[model samples]
Target: MRLRLRQFRLRTGPHEHRVVQPGQPLRHTSLRAPEPIGTLLGDHDGLNRLAGLFSFAAYSRHTIVHVPLRDSVPPDEGVGELVDLVLAHHTLGLRPSRWPALRRNLVGGTPLTVRTDEARTDRDSTSWRERHERTDGRGDLRHATHARTFFLFGNRDVFASAAMSLALAAGWGPRQKGVVKGHSAFMTALPTLVQPPGGGHPLELLVCFKPYPPYAHFRRPGRRGERRSAPS
Candidate 1:
């Protein structure tokens, strides 16, 4: 099995849990387990994203056993120790083993229901009521909406194969979004795969870098020695 590790900053909403609201935009940072098992099957990136999003920081730090399944058992379960290490480093007070619930819910065959609410006040449930009363029913009323439901797969290969199959069955068009960025190793391997004797798969990877906006402007010289407007 081959492994791929990655990191990303995910943008989320203010009401979203699992994020620390420090007077800034909500973002999630994570370190995923190596995807050796996922690489063979093909949906490495998809699977990694799924795990990163659902795998809460608290539980994974404790219960995740990194040893190969074939290895002999250690005298003492090290999950608790691993959890402690994570807490000490990140200062996030979360139990490491609590993640099995999330994993089970995702991997289980049954359909799962995810709930979200716009106005939730745990400390004072009447906060919303008071606000609504003060505004005389003209205040912004937010309702809980059901977002997309993701059918969980055990590994990356299955996810990729399913996606490719779906894309082939459903004709590609404007609604379909292509890959934006890929790891350097994956980018290098792509050229060889696209060489002669290989059919070019109807797929594309669009790499978009953030554009730097002009902070200041200056009058510079042109090639013809004329004054030109430039950004500094």
Candidate 2:
């Protein structure tokens, strides 16, 4: 599918999240894993704005993106182009895996519900330590919101996660928002390290979309394209 790319500025709130820069390696927070790089894109009253929420939730001044409606295209071709877009923009260090499952989800119309708030709740639970050690050990967990659940990517699966998020934003079907306090695999894996040309936001890219429900929250606000601060 053909896509239109646009550039915009976005700012982060006060949180200790990493930002992507040009010619730098993808750095981890410690020996464990890297913090998720949050990105948001949508349109408001005929004006499209791509903003960053950082670690928490804030919109100030930096750089982000907004993918306007994508051209109608077949699923396989669309996925291929998006994968190329992501890889062309950043070096993800992808492994040899064919990403069969990721392609399946995109082509077969699998429903994905990301509970972005689950990590926090899991951290505060009394049995947190036991659960962390027993499971992925990263405090990132996924459970079915209903019966029609599918696989969720974590454990440094940045390439697949990034592709999935881009596909969802660009018209991949059956995307919905749920709550999970745990860390976000997709957000953490988002490609946000490159510096835009001509001196602008630290990281910026052009994406394409078809008005999916996942980003509907950004379409209308108290004011059009108003600057919003990160949440405390």
Candidate 3:
């Protein structure tokens, strides 16, 4: 069966930016500032609704690692604590140890760190792109050819247009397989066009619907619960 690979980017904020190459420096920074806490929470709620739709699908085994490319300042609780914050608030399911060496390598290094929450704020966007390329070559990321891989970026266009080009130019397509998923105000903002490497399959956009706040009104209360009197 032909695999239905999908790709896109996650837009954290108007100013949030990303680099596709993994080891290069971020050439530009997002003009938008970090999203407000309320907005983030709302987005998470939407994601949860979407997740419910795929609960029954037979998804392949996959691991999610949080790369601290940006927001590297160690919170009062440190990187591990920050990872937990992402989990509890966003339900992203990222583990703390997935990128254990992120702190020391955020700067002066390849710009890619598997560390927890070390603030990577200092480095510009190009760094993450360069680091992603390096990791794709030397790390478990190489498994993409055999297993489906997805690189979720802050902006799909930026990474796809920039990073994919670099990978192709460097002769890395045969080894890397999978797609990019872009996150925007809504998933619909992602582009419909995609030119796969070396005449590969075209990129596809997958839409997952998120439940809106009004859904709560449609839900019925449990039988065991005592009902309160309706207001006149």
What is the lDDT of every predicted structure here?
0.21, 0.24, 0.23
lDDT of 2 by residue, 81-125 (tens): 211111211222222242233223232222222212323322333
Runs of candidate 2 with Cα error greater than 4 angstroms are 1-41, 44-93, 96-106, 109-112, 118-203, 206-232
Error of 2 at 130 (Å): 28
TM-score pick, better of 1 and 3: 3
Local lDDT at 52 for model 1: 28
lDDT for each residue of candidate 3 in 1-232, tens digit (9 for 90 to 100): 1112121122333522121122321111111111111011112222222222111011211212222223322212111112111101012332234323322232332232332111222121244445545654221111111011122323222223222222222232111222111112222212222233586554433222222223232222243564534424
Evaluated at residue 116, the lDDT of candidate 2 is 28
For residues 1-232, write the lDDT of model 1, one tens digit per residue. Answer: 1222222122224321132111111111111111110111112232222222222221222222111111112112111111101111122232334323322332212222222121221212233334544654332211111111111211222222222322222222211232112111121100011112345442221111111122122122122654534635
Measured by lDDT, the strongest candidate is 2
> How many clashes in each candidate?
6, 17, 40
- Report the C-alpha displacement of residue 207, candidate 1, in angstroms: 18
TM-score of each: 0.15, 0.21, 0.20
Candidate 3 residues lying further than 4 Å off, grouped into runs, are: 1-149, 152-194, 198-201, 212-232
Superior candidate under lDDT, 1 versus 2 = 2
